[model samples]
Target: MRSLVLCLLTVVAFGSCLKLPSSFKKCDRKRTDFNQCLSDAIYGALKILDKPLPSHGLPSLYDIEFPDEVATIGNRTYGLLQTYYRPRCIGLSKPENINAKLEFGPLTSTLTIEATYSQLTVETGFEAQGTIVLLPVNVVTPFEYTLVNPTYTFTFELEEYEKGTTYFRVIDSKLDMQAHGLKLDYKQLFSNKILNDEFNSAMNVKWREIFALSKSIDEDVFAPLFGTIVNGFLKRVPVADLFDG
Candidate 1:
Protein backbone atom coordinates (compact mmCIF):
# COMPACT_ATOMS: atom_id res chain seq x y z
CA MET A 1 0.00 0.00 0.00
CA ARG A 2 2.92 2.33 0.70
CA SER A 3 4.05 1.57 -2.82
CA LEU A 4 0.76 2.84 -4.22
CA VAL A 5 1.06 6.21 -2.46
CA LEU A 6 4.77 6.51 -3.16
CA CYS A 7 4.10 5.79 -6.81
CA LEU A 8 1.88 8.86 -6.75
CA LEU A 9 4.58 10.77 -4.89
CA THR A 10 7.11 9.91 -7.57
CA VAL A 11 4.96 11.85 -9.99
CA VAL A 12 4.08 14.55 -7.49
CA ALA A 13 7.74 15.20 -6.79
CA PHE A 14 8.30 16.12 -10.39
CA GLY A 15 5.00 17.81 -11.13
CA SER A 16 5.99 20.62 -8.77
CA CYS A 17 8.10 22.04 -11.59
CA LEU A 18 6.47 25.48 -11.40
CA LYS A 19 8.70 26.01 -8.41
CA LEU A 20 10.90 22.99 -8.14
CA PRO A 21 12.37 22.05 -4.80
CA SER A 22 16.10 22.30 -4.54
CA SER A 23 16.33 18.63 -3.59
CA PHE A 24 14.74 17.54 -6.87
CA LYS A 25 16.64 17.31 -10.15
CA LYS A 26 14.67 17.95 -13.32
CA CYS A 27 14.83 15.56 -16.28
CA ASP A 28 14.55 16.68 -19.88
CA ARG A 29 11.60 14.96 -21.51
CA LYS A 30 13.56 14.53 -24.73
CA ARG A 31 16.67 13.09 -23.14
CA THR A 32 17.64 9.56 -24.17
CA ASP A 33 18.24 8.78 -20.48
CA PHE A 34 15.01 10.33 -19.24
CA ASN A 35 13.92 7.21 -17.42
CA GLN A 36 17.18 6.93 -15.54
CA CYS A 37 17.11 10.61 -14.70
CA LEU A 38 13.56 10.27 -13.36
CA SER A 39 14.52 7.30 -11.24
CA ASP A 40 17.40 9.21 -9.70
CA ALA A 41 15.22 12.30 -9.11
CA ILE A 42 12.52 10.23 -7.41
CA TYR A 43 15.07 8.64 -5.10
CA GLY A 44 16.42 12.03 -4.12
CA ALA A 45 12.94 13.48 -3.61
CA LEU A 46 11.82 10.74 -1.22
CA LYS A 47 14.23 11.88 1.47
CA ILE A 48 12.53 15.27 1.83
CA LEU A 49 8.92 14.45 0.91
CA ASP A 50 8.10 12.99 4.30
CA LYS A 51 7.48 16.53 5.51
CA PRO A 52 4.60 18.59 4.26
CA LEU A 53 5.41 21.06 1.47
CA PRO A 54 2.53 23.45 1.13
CA SER A 55 4.35 25.51 -1.46
CA HIS A 56 4.63 22.36 -3.58
CA GLY A 57 1.03 21.24 -2.88
CA LEU A 58 2.32 18.03 -1.32
CA PRO A 59 1.38 16.73 2.11
CA SER A 60 3.60 15.16 4.69
CA LEU A 61 4.06 11.46 4.15
CA TYR A 62 4.70 10.69 7.80
CA ASP A 63 1.18 11.32 9.11
CA ILE A 64 -1.07 10.05 6.36
CA GLU A 65 -4.35 8.89 7.86
CA PHE A 66 -7.29 6.94 6.52
CA PRO A 67 -10.91 7.13 7.51
CA ASP A 68 -13.02 4.21 8.64
CA GLU A 69 -13.18 1.34 6.18
CA VAL A 70 -15.25 -1.84 5.88
CA ALA A 71 -14.38 -4.62 3.48
CA THR A 72 -15.35 -8.22 2.98
CA ILE A 73 -13.24 -10.76 1.13
CA GLY A 74 -13.79 -14.38 0.10
CA ASN A 75 -16.89 -16.57 -0.04
CA ARG A 76 -19.42 -16.91 2.73
CA THR A 77 -17.89 -20.21 3.78
CA TYR A 78 -14.41 -18.73 4.05
CA GLY A 79 -14.41 -14.98 4.30
CA LEU A 80 -13.51 -12.03 6.46
CA LEU A 81 -15.56 -8.95 7.31
CA GLN A 82 -13.13 -6.38 8.56
CA THR A 83 -13.70 -2.79 9.67
CA TYR A 84 -10.88 -0.40 10.29
CA TYR A 85 -10.93 3.02 11.98
CA ARG A 86 -8.32 5.73 12.01
CA PRO A 87 -5.64 3.61 10.44
CA ARG A 88 -2.23 5.26 10.48
CA CYS A 89 0.82 3.99 8.68
CA ILE A 90 4.53 4.66 9.19
CA GLY A 91 7.94 3.20 8.48
CA LEU A 92 8.05 3.49 4.73
CA SER A 93 11.50 2.38 3.70
CA LYS A 94 13.29 4.04 0.82
CA PRO A 95 13.14 2.18 -2.44
CA GLU A 96 16.12 -0.07 -3.10
CA ASN A 97 15.85 -0.10 -6.88
CA ILE A 98 13.32 1.93 -8.82
CA ASN A 99 12.56 2.22 -12.51
CA ALA A 100 10.29 4.54 -14.47
CA LYS A 101 9.15 4.34 -18.07
CA LEU A 102 7.29 7.15 -19.75
CA GLU A 103 5.39 7.10 -23.03
CA PHE A 104 3.91 10.25 -24.48
CA GLY A 105 1.07 9.87 -26.93
CA PRO A 106 -0.79 12.31 -29.15
CA LEU A 107 -3.74 12.65 -26.77
CA THR A 108 -2.56 11.00 -23.58
CA SER A 109 0.53 9.61 -21.87
CA THR A 110 1.46 6.65 -19.69
CA LEU A 111 3.73 6.30 -16.68
CA THR A 112 4.90 2.91 -15.47
CA ILE A 113 6.97 2.18 -12.42
CA GLU A 114 8.49 -0.77 -10.61
CA ALA A 115 9.53 0.00 -7.04
CA THR A 116 10.98 -2.26 -4.34
CA TYR A 117 10.96 -1.44 -0.66
CA SER A 118 12.85 -3.13 2.14
CA GLN A 119 10.09 -2.80 4.73
CA LEU A 120 6.86 -1.01 5.72
CA THR A 121 4.61 -1.11 8.79
CA VAL A 122 1.00 -0.14 9.44
CA GLU A 123 -1.08 0.12 12.61
CA THR A 124 -4.83 0.38 12.88
CA GLY A 125 -7.76 0.04 15.19
CA PHE A 126 -10.16 -2.49 13.77
CA GLU A 127 -12.89 -5.03 14.38
CA ALA A 128 -13.00 -8.34 12.55
CA GLN A 129 -15.87 -10.74 12.25
CA GLY A 130 -15.94 -13.59 9.83
CA THR A 131 -15.57 -17.32 9.22
CA ILE A 132 -12.33 -19.02 8.29
CA VAL A 133 -12.80 -22.45 6.71
CA LEU A 134 -15.96 -22.93 8.85
CA LEU A 135 -14.58 -21.52 12.10
CA PRO A 136 -16.43 -18.43 13.27
CA VAL A 137 -14.28 -15.46 14.32
CA ASN A 138 -15.05 -12.33 16.31
CA VAL A 139 -12.33 -10.05 17.49
CA VAL A 140 -11.57 -6.42 18.18
CA THR A 141 -7.95 -5.48 18.43
CA PRO A 142 -5.35 -2.96 17.43
CA PHE A 143 -3.85 -4.45 14.31
CA GLU A 144 -0.21 -4.17 13.30
CA TYR A 145 1.39 -5.57 10.18
CA THR A 146 4.92 -5.31 8.85
CA LEU A 147 5.80 -6.30 5.32
CA VAL A 148 9.32 -7.05 4.16
CA ASN A 149 10.80 -6.80 0.69
CA PRO A 150 7.61 -5.62 -0.96
CA THR A 151 7.60 -4.79 -4.64
CA TYR A 152 4.98 -3.01 -6.70
CA THR A 153 4.36 -2.31 -10.37
CA PHE A 154 1.80 0.27 -11.41
CA THR A 155 0.79 2.01 -14.63
CA PHE A 156 -0.95 5.34 -14.88
CA GLU A 157 -2.74 6.57 -17.98
CA LEU A 158 -2.69 10.34 -17.88
CA GLU A 159 -4.42 12.94 -19.96
CA GLU A 160 -4.22 16.69 -19.78
CA TYR A 161 -7.28 18.22 -18.16
CA GLU A 162 -8.34 21.86 -17.99
CA LYS A 163 -8.28 23.20 -14.45
CA GLY A 164 -7.41 26.82 -15.23
CA THR A 165 -4.19 25.35 -16.64
CA THR A 166 -3.46 22.15 -18.61
CA TYR A 167 -2.84 19.84 -15.67
CA PHE A 168 -2.63 16.06 -15.74
CA ARG A 169 -5.20 13.67 -14.35
CA VAL A 170 -5.14 9.92 -14.24
CA ILE A 171 -7.50 8.48 -16.81
CA ASP A 172 -6.78 4.95 -15.60
CA SER A 173 -4.38 2.99 -13.38
CA LYS A 174 -3.30 -0.58 -12.67
CA LEU A 175 -1.46 -1.87 -9.62
CA ASP A 176 0.14 -5.18 -8.62
CA MET A 177 1.97 -5.90 -5.38
CA GLN A 178 3.92 -8.79 -3.85
CA ALA A 179 5.97 -9.28 -0.75
CA HIS A 180 8.58 -11.75 0.49
CA GLY A 181 7.56 -11.60 4.14
CA LEU A 182 4.64 -10.45 6.31
CA LYS A 183 4.33 -10.31 10.05
CA LEU A 184 0.90 -9.76 11.58
CA ASP A 185 -0.08 -9.66 15.22
CA TYR A 186 -3.32 -9.02 17.04
CA LYS A 187 -3.96 -9.12 20.79
CA GLN A 188 -6.86 -11.56 21.13
CA LEU A 189 -9.31 -13.74 19.21
CA PHE A 190 -12.69 -15.22 20.07
CA SER A 191 -11.95 -14.79 23.77
CA ASN A 192 -10.08 -18.09 23.70
CA LYS A 193 -6.31 -18.61 23.96
CA ILE A 194 -6.11 -21.81 21.90
CA LEU A 195 -8.28 -20.36 19.18
CA ASN A 196 -6.11 -17.27 19.08
CA ASP A 197 -2.91 -19.25 18.70
CA GLU A 198 -4.40 -21.51 16.08
CA PHE A 199 -5.77 -18.59 14.11
CA ASN A 200 -2.47 -16.76 14.16
CA SER A 201 -0.64 -19.88 13.08
CA ALA A 202 -3.10 -20.50 10.29
CA MET A 203 -2.84 -16.95 9.04
CA ASN A 204 0.95 -17.08 8.93
CA VAL A 205 0.87 -20.37 7.06
CA LYS A 206 -1.60 -19.16 4.45
CA TRP A 207 -0.83 -15.51 4.07
CA ARG A 208 -0.08 -15.82 0.38
CA GLU A 209 -3.47 -17.34 -0.37
CA ILE A 210 -5.11 -14.80 1.88
CA PHE A 211 -3.37 -11.93 0.15
CA ALA A 212 -4.37 -13.27 -3.25
CA LEU A 213 -7.96 -13.62 -2.21
CA SER A 214 -8.03 -10.05 -0.99
CA LYS A 215 -5.98 -8.44 -3.73
CA SER A 216 -8.95 -7.34 -5.79
CA ILE A 217 -10.68 -5.94 -2.75
CA ASP A 218 -7.60 -3.96 -1.90
CA GLU A 219 -7.30 -2.59 -5.41
CA ASP A 220 -10.90 -1.49 -5.47
CA VAL A 221 -10.49 0.44 -2.25
CA PHE A 222 -7.03 1.94 -2.71
CA ALA A 223 -6.53 2.61 -6.42
CA PRO A 224 -8.93 5.52 -6.62
CA LEU A 225 -7.78 6.97 -3.34
CA PHE A 226 -4.22 7.03 -4.58
CA GLY A 227 -5.30 8.70 -7.78
CA THR A 228 -7.14 11.41 -5.90
CA ILE A 229 -4.10 12.15 -3.83
CA VAL A 230 -1.90 12.28 -6.90
CA ASN A 231 -4.24 14.61 -8.69
CA GLY A 232 -4.45 16.95 -5.74
CA PHE A 233 -1.00 18.18 -6.69
CA LEU A 234 -0.80 17.24 -10.32
CA LYS A 235 -3.88 19.32 -10.99
CA ARG A 236 -2.09 22.33 -9.62
CA VAL A 237 0.48 22.51 -12.41
CA PRO A 238 0.35 22.10 -16.17
CA VAL A 239 2.07 19.15 -17.81
CA ALA A 240 4.01 21.43 -20.13
CA ASP A 241 5.23 23.40 -17.16
CA LEU A 242 6.64 20.27 -15.54
CA PHE A 243 9.21 19.39 -18.23
CA ASP A 244 11.59 21.33 -20.42
CA GLY A 245 10.77 21.18 -24.10
Candidate 2:
Protein backbone atom coordinates (compact mmCIF):
# COMPACT_ATOMS: atom_id res chain seq x y z
CA MET A 1 0.00 0.00 0.00
CA ARG A 2 2.89 2.39 0.74
CA SER A 3 4.49 1.79 -2.65
CA LEU A 4 1.15 2.31 -4.47
CA VAL A 5 0.54 5.60 -2.65
CA LEU A 6 4.01 6.91 -3.66
CA CYS A 7 3.42 5.99 -7.32
CA LEU A 8 0.04 7.84 -7.32
CA LEU A 9 1.63 10.98 -5.83
CA THR A 10 4.41 11.01 -8.52
CA VAL A 11 1.82 10.73 -11.30
CA VAL A 12 -0.18 13.67 -9.90
CA ALA A 13 2.98 15.91 -9.72
CA PHE A 14 3.93 15.09 -13.35
CA GLY A 15 0.45 16.04 -14.59
CA SER A 16 0.55 19.36 -12.75
CA CYS A 17 3.95 20.25 -14.24
CA LEU A 18 2.73 19.57 -17.79
CA LYS A 19 -0.37 21.76 -17.38
CA LEU A 20 0.54 25.50 -17.46
CA PRO A 21 -1.64 28.21 -15.79
CA SER A 22 -4.00 30.15 -18.11
CA SER A 23 -2.02 33.37 -17.70
CA PHE A 24 1.27 31.68 -18.58
CA LYS A 25 -0.25 30.24 -21.74
CA LYS A 26 -1.47 33.62 -22.99
CA CYS A 27 0.49 35.18 -25.87
CA ASP A 28 2.54 38.31 -25.12
CA ARG A 29 1.13 41.57 -26.51
CA LYS A 30 4.52 43.26 -26.95
CA ARG A 31 5.88 40.51 -29.19
CA THR A 32 3.65 41.55 -32.07
CA ASP A 33 5.37 41.37 -35.50
CA PHE A 34 6.98 44.82 -35.72
CA ASN A 35 7.43 44.64 -39.47
CA GLN A 36 3.70 44.29 -39.96
CA CYS A 37 2.81 46.90 -37.38
CA LEU A 38 5.25 49.40 -38.87
CA SER A 39 3.68 49.07 -42.26
CA ASP A 40 0.21 49.59 -40.83
CA ALA A 41 1.26 52.65 -38.88
CA ILE A 42 2.90 54.35 -41.86
CA TYR A 43 -0.13 53.74 -44.03
CA GLY A 44 -2.46 54.88 -41.27
CA ALA A 45 -0.68 58.23 -40.96
CA LEU A 46 -1.23 59.07 -44.64
CA LYS A 47 -4.89 58.07 -44.75
CA ILE A 48 -5.66 61.35 -43.02
CA LEU A 49 -5.65 63.22 -46.35
CA ASP A 50 -7.32 60.60 -48.50
CA LYS A 51 -9.96 62.56 -50.33
CA PRO A 52 -10.81 63.38 -53.95
CA LEU A 53 -8.40 65.72 -55.69
CA PRO A 54 -10.17 68.93 -56.59
CA SER A 55 -10.48 69.53 -60.30
CA HIS A 56 -8.24 72.25 -61.65
CA GLY A 57 -9.70 75.81 -61.81
CA LEU A 58 -12.57 74.98 -59.41
CA PRO A 59 -12.88 77.99 -57.15
CA SER A 60 -14.19 76.29 -54.03
CA LEU A 61 -13.12 74.10 -51.15
CA TYR A 62 -13.04 70.43 -52.22
CA ASP A 63 -11.60 67.09 -51.18
CA ILE A 64 -8.22 65.83 -52.44
CA GLU A 65 -8.49 62.10 -52.92
CA PHE A 66 -5.77 59.47 -52.86
CA PRO A 67 -5.27 56.63 -55.24
CA ASP A 68 -6.98 53.32 -54.50
CA GLU A 69 -3.50 51.85 -54.00
CA VAL A 70 -1.21 54.66 -52.93
CA ALA A 71 1.82 52.55 -52.26
CA THR A 72 3.27 49.09 -51.46
CA ILE A 73 5.76 48.52 -48.70
CA GLY A 74 7.27 45.05 -48.61
CA ASN A 75 4.43 42.53 -48.60
CA ARG A 76 1.89 45.18 -47.55
CA THR A 77 -0.28 47.59 -49.54
CA TYR A 78 -2.00 50.84 -48.52
CA GLY A 79 -4.92 52.93 -49.81
CA LEU A 80 -6.85 56.05 -48.79
CA LEU A 81 -10.63 56.56 -49.09
CA GLN A 82 -11.93 59.99 -47.93
CA THR A 83 -11.11 63.45 -46.47
CA TYR A 84 -12.79 66.67 -45.17
CA TYR A 85 -12.19 70.35 -45.87
CA ARG A 86 -12.44 73.93 -44.54
CA PRO A 87 -11.41 76.69 -46.94
CA ARG A 88 -9.53 79.78 -45.81
CA CYS A 89 -7.44 82.50 -47.46
CA ILE A 90 -4.27 81.06 -46.02
CA GLY A 91 -4.99 77.31 -46.29
CA LEU A 92 -7.59 74.57 -46.05
CA SER A 93 -8.15 72.68 -42.80
CA LYS A 94 -8.00 68.91 -43.35
CA PRO A 95 -10.71 66.64 -42.07
CA GLU A 96 -10.51 64.46 -38.95
CA ASN A 97 -9.97 60.70 -38.92
CA ILE A 98 -9.22 60.36 -42.62
CA ASN A 99 -9.84 56.65 -43.26
CA ALA A 100 -7.40 54.13 -44.76
CA LYS A 101 -6.35 50.50 -44.66
CA LEU A 102 -3.26 48.31 -44.96
CA GLU A 103 -3.29 44.77 -46.25
CA PHE A 104 -0.59 42.18 -45.72
CA GLY A 105 -1.48 38.74 -47.03
CA PRO A 106 -4.64 37.84 -45.07
CA LEU A 107 -4.17 40.54 -42.41
CA THR A 108 -5.77 43.99 -42.55
CA SER A 109 -4.96 47.06 -40.41
CA THR A 110 -7.12 50.18 -40.20
CA LEU A 111 -5.94 53.66 -39.17
CA THR A 112 -6.85 57.37 -38.87
CA ILE A 113 -4.87 60.61 -39.38
CA GLU A 114 -5.73 64.11 -38.17
CA ALA A 115 -4.87 66.47 -40.98
CA THR A 116 -3.96 70.14 -40.53
CA TYR A 117 -2.41 72.94 -42.58
CA SER A 118 0.33 75.56 -42.68
CA GLN A 119 -0.59 78.66 -44.64
CA LEU A 120 1.42 81.09 -46.75
CA THR A 121 -0.68 84.12 -47.54
CA VAL A 122 0.25 86.52 -50.36
CA GLU A 123 -1.60 89.82 -50.23
CA THR A 124 -1.13 92.59 -52.82
CA GLY A 125 -2.60 96.09 -52.67
CA PHE A 126 -2.43 98.11 -55.89
CA GLU A 127 -3.54 101.53 -57.14
CA ALA A 128 -5.72 101.78 -60.23
CA GLN A 129 -3.99 103.39 -63.23
CA GLY A 130 -6.83 104.53 -65.52
CA THR A 131 -9.51 106.87 -64.14
CA ILE A 132 -12.43 109.00 -65.41
CA VAL A 133 -14.19 112.14 -64.09
CA LEU A 134 -18.02 111.92 -64.00
CA LEU A 135 -18.43 115.72 -64.23
CA PRO A 136 -15.97 118.42 -65.43
CA VAL A 137 -17.02 120.59 -62.47
CA ASN A 138 -16.52 117.63 -60.12
CA VAL A 139 -12.75 117.51 -59.50
CA VAL A 140 -12.90 113.85 -58.31
CA THR A 141 -12.17 110.94 -60.74
CA PRO A 142 -13.35 107.30 -60.30
CA PHE A 143 -11.14 104.16 -60.64
CA GLU A 144 -12.63 100.80 -61.69
CA TYR A 145 -10.72 97.54 -61.16
CA THR A 146 -10.74 94.13 -59.41
CA LEU A 147 -8.60 92.25 -56.93
CA VAL A 148 -7.20 88.73 -57.47
CA ASN A 149 -6.72 86.21 -54.65
CA PRO A 150 -4.91 82.95 -55.49
CA THR A 151 -4.18 79.95 -53.29
CA TYR A 152 -2.10 76.85 -53.75
CA THR A 153 -2.45 73.47 -52.07
CA PHE A 154 0.64 71.36 -51.40
CA THR A 155 0.43 67.58 -50.98
CA PHE A 156 3.04 64.97 -50.03
CA GLU A 157 3.89 61.29 -50.39
CA LEU A 158 6.70 58.87 -49.42
CA GLU A 159 8.74 57.48 -52.28
CA GLU A 160 11.90 55.45 -51.58
CA TYR A 161 14.01 54.10 -48.76
CA GLU A 162 17.42 52.74 -47.85
CA LYS A 163 18.49 50.93 -44.68
CA GLY A 164 16.50 52.31 -41.77
CA THR A 165 16.03 55.66 -43.54
CA THR A 166 13.22 56.54 -45.94
CA TYR A 167 12.90 59.14 -48.66
CA PHE A 168 9.72 60.98 -49.59
CA ARG A 169 8.61 62.43 -52.89
CA VAL A 170 5.87 64.91 -53.68
CA ILE A 171 3.36 62.31 -54.82
CA ASP A 172 0.38 64.46 -55.89
CA SER A 173 0.27 68.22 -55.48
CA LYS A 174 -2.00 71.09 -56.54
CA LEU A 175 -2.02 74.86 -56.99
CA ASP A 176 -5.45 76.44 -56.99
CA MET A 177 -7.32 79.55 -55.98
CA GLN A 178 -8.95 79.30 -52.57
CA ALA A 179 -10.91 82.52 -52.99
CA HIS A 180 -11.44 84.75 -56.07
CA GLY A 181 -14.23 87.09 -55.12
CA LEU A 182 -13.81 90.46 -56.70
CA LYS A 183 -12.68 93.43 -54.61
CA LEU A 184 -14.04 96.63 -56.15
CA ASP A 185 -14.21 100.28 -55.18
CA TYR A 186 -17.18 100.77 -52.85
CA LYS A 187 -17.57 104.48 -53.72
CA GLN A 188 -16.46 106.42 -56.81
CA LEU A 189 -14.96 109.11 -54.59
CA PHE A 190 -11.24 108.96 -55.42
CA SER A 191 -9.40 109.35 -58.79
CA ASN A 192 -5.62 108.84 -58.43
CA LYS A 193 -5.91 105.04 -57.88
CA ILE A 194 -3.27 103.03 -59.78
CA LEU A 195 -2.85 99.19 -60.08
CA ASN A 196 0.67 97.75 -59.63
CA ASP A 197 1.30 94.80 -61.96
CA GLU A 198 4.98 94.62 -61.10
CA PHE A 199 4.29 93.84 -57.47
CA ASN A 200 1.81 91.08 -58.42
CA SER A 201 4.29 89.53 -60.82
CA ALA A 202 7.00 89.59 -58.19
CA MET A 203 4.69 87.85 -55.73
CA ASN A 204 3.91 85.11 -58.24
CA VAL A 205 7.60 84.53 -58.83
CA LYS A 206 8.19 84.21 -55.11
CA TRP A 207 5.46 81.59 -54.82
CA ARG A 208 6.96 79.61 -57.69
CA GLU A 209 10.35 79.68 -56.03
CA ILE A 210 8.83 78.42 -52.79
CA PHE A 211 7.08 75.55 -54.56
CA ALA A 212 10.26 74.56 -56.37
CA LEU A 213 12.19 74.67 -53.14
CA SER A 214 9.68 72.40 -51.50
CA LYS A 215 10.21 69.72 -54.18
CA SER A 216 13.99 69.70 -54.09
CA ILE A 217 15.38 66.69 -52.23
CA ASP A 218 18.68 68.43 -51.56
CA GLU A 219 19.05 69.10 -47.86
CA ASP A 220 19.81 72.74 -48.47
CA VAL A 221 16.77 73.12 -50.68
CA PHE A 222 14.05 71.14 -48.95
CA ALA A 223 15.12 70.77 -45.32
CA PRO A 224 13.27 73.79 -44.04
CA LEU A 225 10.07 72.93 -45.92
CA PHE A 226 10.30 69.25 -44.99
CA GLY A 227 10.66 70.17 -41.35
CA THR A 228 7.43 72.08 -41.60
CA ILE A 229 5.28 69.21 -42.98
CA VAL A 230 6.76 65.72 -43.46
CA ASN A 231 8.72 65.68 -40.20
CA GLY A 232 5.55 65.89 -38.17
CA PHE A 233 4.05 62.91 -39.98
CA LEU A 234 7.20 60.83 -39.55
CA LYS A 235 7.32 61.52 -35.83
CA ARG A 236 3.70 60.43 -35.40
CA VAL A 237 4.11 57.11 -37.24
CA PRO A 238 6.35 54.07 -36.78
CA VAL A 239 8.74 53.40 -39.62
CA ALA A 240 9.65 49.83 -40.52
CA ASP A 241 13.28 48.79 -40.72
CA LEU A 242 14.06 49.60 -44.32
CA PHE A 243 16.99 47.13 -44.26
CA ASP A 244 14.72 44.16 -43.58
CA GLY A 245 15.47 41.58 -46.24
Q: Pick the candidate with the highest lDDT.
A: 1
- Which tens-of-lDDT digit does each residue in 207-239 have in candidate 1? 787667756765566566556666676776676
Which digits, one per residue and each the tens of the lDDT, describe model 2 over residues 1-245? 98777656744743211121121112222444543544344334334224321221112222322122111112111222111112112222322222222222222222222223332231222122222232222222222223234232333334443322332223322222232432323133333233234433444445545344322322232223423344333322223322122
* Off by more than 4 A, model 2: 1-122, 125-157, 176-245
The lowest-lDDT stretch of 10 consecutive residues in candidate 2 is 69-78
For every model shown, what is its TM-score relative to the native structure? 0.79, 0.23
Q: By TM-score, how accurate is candidate 1?
A: 0.79
Question: Looking at candidate 2, what is the lDDT of residue 23?
Answer: 19
